[model samples]
Target: MNRAVAHPQQDGQDRPGPTTRLSVNIGEATAQVLQKHKARGISITETVRRACAVYDLIESEAAKGSKIQIVDRDGTTRELLLIP
Candidate 1:
């Protein structure tokens, strides 16, 4: 039998505890992305933190519309949506 141990907490670490009981329904696609990251040895908390940080950097909606961009599977850039 194999047992997994929790990683030890080191001194001077500033990691936050998981949010208090916030439940969200993640769709299948999102679950796959999270699973992929986990398989690559990245913690879900870190992935969520990185996502929130990038999302925070996006520009706010002014009188002009916000631009939405996406890269296609074939490496082409496409403007998918615009919202004012």
Candidate 2:
């Protein structure tokens, strides 16, 4: 077996910094969405935050089955096929 080095044998100054990580390669359609957001004077960070919130909401909804009752209000039971 062989070992691999995770970092250089140099001081921390040789390591990459945080700003190098804050960049991403967004596609054309994603750029269009960002541009529309910019028209509303929103920063990229805000856009990403909003997107994450919406994603969480959608996933939660899909995970939770609706509480609606298909049976009549006369105390009847109904068969439900949950997409589990």
Cα RMSD for candidates in order: 12.0, 16.4
Error in Å for residue 70 of model 2: 20
lDDT of 1 by residue, 43-75 (tens): 766666566544543333222455546668998
Q: What is the C-alpha lDDT of each candidate?
A: 0.58, 0.57
The whole-model C-alpha lDDT of candidate 2 against the native structure comes to 0.57
Clash number for each model: 0, 0
Question: Candidate 2 on 1-84: residue-level lDDT in tens?
Answer: 332223322232323664232578999999999989979987666676567655555455546753323466897976544454
Per-residue lDDT, model 2, residue 83, is 51
